[model samples]
Target chain A: MDYCRSGFKPKRSLEIILFTSEEPTRFGISCLGSRLLAGSEALAEALKATVDGQNISFLEAARSAGYARDEDDLSRVFLKNDSYSAFVELHIEQAPILEEEGISIGVVTNIAAPASIKVDFEGNGGHAGGVLMPDRNDAGLAAAELMLAIEKHATESGSLDTVGTVGILELYPGAINSIPSKAHLEIDVRDIEESFRNAVINKIHKAAKSIAKKRKVTLSEFKIINQDPPAHSNGSVIKAVVDASDELNLTYKYMISRAYHDSLFMARIAPMGMIFIPCYKGYSHKPEEYASPQDLENGVKVLALTLAKLSLR
Target chain B: MDYCRSGFKPKRSLEIILFTSEEPTRFGISCLGSRLLAGSEALAEALKATVDGQNISFLEAARSAGYARDEDDLSRVFLKNDSYSAFVELHIEQAPILEEEGISIGVVTNIAAPASIKVDFEGNGGHAGGVLMPDRNDAGLAAAELMLAIEKHATESGSLDTVGTVGILELYPGAINSIPSKAHLEIDVRDIEESFRNAVINKIHKAAKSIAKKRKVTLSEFKIINQDPPAHSNGSVIKAVVDASDELNLTYKYMISRAYHDSLFMARIAPMGMIFIPCYKGYSHKPEEYASPQDLENGVKVLALTLAKLSLR
Candidate 1:
């Protein structure tokens, strides 16, 4: 922003695009910014070659949902001569690997996309006092069992870079004295290895089915809230970040990003790279999450040099 | 009420009392109406002899809380010579025994009072994604084990009329992505026999301690919210109801009411009896709870006969 204010012009006709895709599309993708890149001809073709209607493409859904294309939006028109050659994003490393190793800069190798699932369990409701064990079918108890089972399966799977989380566990008509008749759980499973995630999720499915049968409760089909594969950074773009990191005298690592960012979808259209700064104790998504001033300055210098190098080429 | 309106009065000067003790006192004992009866000379002495300062008598609390007395209220003054002889109450049976058996009436022999316990478990919190087993203390998992253990202990207690219930089981900061740091459970245990209740509660205490130790979580002291000994109906009053049922030709059973009512505390003062008519499927505390017209009429006729006999005595 300071360079743009100072009118430091690049060698080429650069627009210095600042995109904000804040809207959430129906497929549960993070933002509408992904939809912008999905609208580009190259990404549309790439996605077509991979996930087949896993759900409708985000941009198609957005368009159908009345997000009309504006002539001013660059993503709606990828001019043959004006295609972007490279992309880069800088973020705080959400995991402890870089921080524990005391690295100043991390060149993210890939982003872990999540497959979110929601399970609804239904059981009989009655006065908690009067319902005896033999006669009572408690949905909350079933949900508790499932939550524990998820933790167990995830732990025992021993798959590297694989993580499962239950973001929401709620009981309906949540009065203390009434037996819960319904329970809803939101589970997010993410891994760099697709096969490993599928294996853990399969185990969870089997466990839930057996528990539901034993407890005589109705377990609803696990709904796929969001499903996206891991996205890898372009090798050449990663080289650019590495080169810049070395130029700036900062140690760098090629680490798998455990957190997802807009760049994951942006990679659909353009070759993309990611730079990460270490946060204290590998904590992110918390108020206490912090990065050292020196590490942040190192990231900014690397980002500037990398952007300039990409633009000049 | 019809007999008094028609001026077909009995030989004695009847007060035809309708008293209300609607305020909840500190001890959480139900039916402050019993407090009015406790204020009566007989019940106060009886309670003082048994339950040691069941929180300094409800009447004392009510008086201090500014419940001004109405001199005209008969309950405010039970003159020495005007000591009551008997008390009887009619209510819907809040259990399935009579409704399931097609019985017309239940001659309740006693009421069950509960000793409710609350336990809080505190554990370390961190990111579910990054926290691995053997290094993580999840309070939510500990809570799940405790809930299941409670069910197990209660099922195995094997004491007749003993019941254990967990009305509230909660995880603190219950977000899906973050590991839960705390758990709270509210347990209610009841039995007609005080020893049986203590036995079940002791088992729960042991189970919670073992679980907290195993999970390495800090457990809060168990709190007793409501503790009252079961109240037994008077033999003479029970005999009166039995005789009335025999005269009215309604089949009756000597039942122990599982749901407490004002009559539970009232039993401490005058010899008291209760009569119950079956509601649909024995469902009380619900909008769909209903008693057949024929069953209600039968209950009313028997209640009138029993009151006449008690008043005559």
Candidate 2:
């Protein structure tokens, strides 16, 4: 994993390689992931120099110039029984990390899951003035109570470490003069453990049911959306990374991800690990989000050296 | 004063007189109270017949129609001296009574004051998931508490006759996942006594202030969109109607208004009294709200006869 930085700038000529080990490769179709050109190209060039009689072809480029699925498949060159049967995906640190830390590489393990759930409470809307509290059904109030209970549930379950969140809840006929007749809430729960995730889900349903009963309102639960739990970096891949870093005498630390990245999904399909480069302010997902070119270069060099070792094996 | 409803319907072209007699003229203006058409026509027709005159005209018609203002001219026809004078105003019941009970006329002594207020609470909005109970202010919950307090205030006002109603409440970004940062509510309160009305207002303000402090949020109060006090009917006019009903052998009862009508305002300008005919099923405001034609005729007849007595002066 020994590498050096040229400058904190983006070079247009950087070559990016996407490996699936299949001939006539299509990149995005299976376990979709993005491969930035500079890192991928650097790794591909490094591997080309390390392997004997390696054939490299430049396929139709992506709209934004990454090695995306359907563009190339590495299965053509490597197979289950082939000497070089392993898959390695190289990409730029879309997020800045090592650049600010003045480190050249970052090793990642796991990513948090993304999810959204909807809870609906139906109740009768009537005159607040005429309806006695004991007789009236209020959905908004039910939702409020349910939200507080949910916060308690998550806190009690110690799920805050995994960070379950409630993002949006809405009521109908939201008029100041009308008692809320119906309410809908969206809860966002995410975690690396399936059991912990399911517990949070169960807690939400229980809260919804009890709140509905207490408010004398009808409540229903539905899964609006969810994403798979991100795969972990393979043990062998982590060993290779640590060995390569040791061989290069590089200072390194193992890390887990709080955010999602293409590597999260790729880890499921192969022995995958990511190398992060420091970003000035850790900014991403915005126009102003940026990373230093020198960090990018150092990150690419680590990937290149790591791939060189894998190619040699 | 005796006016005839000939058969069941009175399409009679009656002569209306213009008069300057203090009693008749004062009665005419009082008659013009809140129910301009009913009171003015009643008095105008009666005066015409008394003077045996045709087409009586008042110079203040434009002013009454809101076309002009009779600011300082006090010597005009019915405008007389600038001293305050009062008259007895008689109103035909807009609400049902005799018609539903098989009676022709029902006298009312008072009108209930209707108060409608809009309470809007404003606060800062933030990420619902990021903000915890103690870290943030919640206007929606505060609004709910305020609503409950309003009910409690109305009940504790010590006037069993008092009534308070919250008809509408709305919250900004009223999503289940988001903490409500702002809330708006509409309150309607009414009572026969002014003291009770003031008390209810005071309680509402007090509750709002306390809730704001408790929630660590700011609150602002404004005049009720509609705030008019209850009006008392004229004792003399009530007696006259009762005596006339007895003499004419018309079925009648003494009652108070449960709903507001234009006559509520007229009662304030003059010694006022009302006669109610029944409405079928107590349905008054909806499109299906109706009173039988026979009930209408009987009400008109009683009203016509009552007018005849005061019109002759």
Best by DockQ: 1
Provide the lowest-lDDT 10-residue window in model 1 chain B. B43-52
Report the CAPRI category for model 1.
acceptable
Candidate 2 residue runs with Cα over 4 Å from true position: A1-313, B1-109, B173-178, B220-227, B236-259, B273-313
Quote the TM-score that chain A achieves in each candidate: 0.81, 0.59
Per-residue lDDT of candidate 1, residues B1-313 (tens digit): 7666766545444444454533223443345456455455444444333322454544454456665443223255433322657777888886667888988989988777667788898876555544444555677777778778777776787865776766566776665555667777777677777787788888888888998899899887678766777889989889889999998888999988766666766666667789999877655444556888998899998888787777776
RMSD of 1: 7.9
TM-score of chain B of 1: 0.79
Give me candidate 2's TM-score against the actual structure: 0.49
Please provide TM-scores, in order, for all candidate models, with all chains considered together: 0.76, 0.49
Docking class of 2: incorrect
How high is the CA lDDT of each candidate model? Answer: 0.70, 0.55
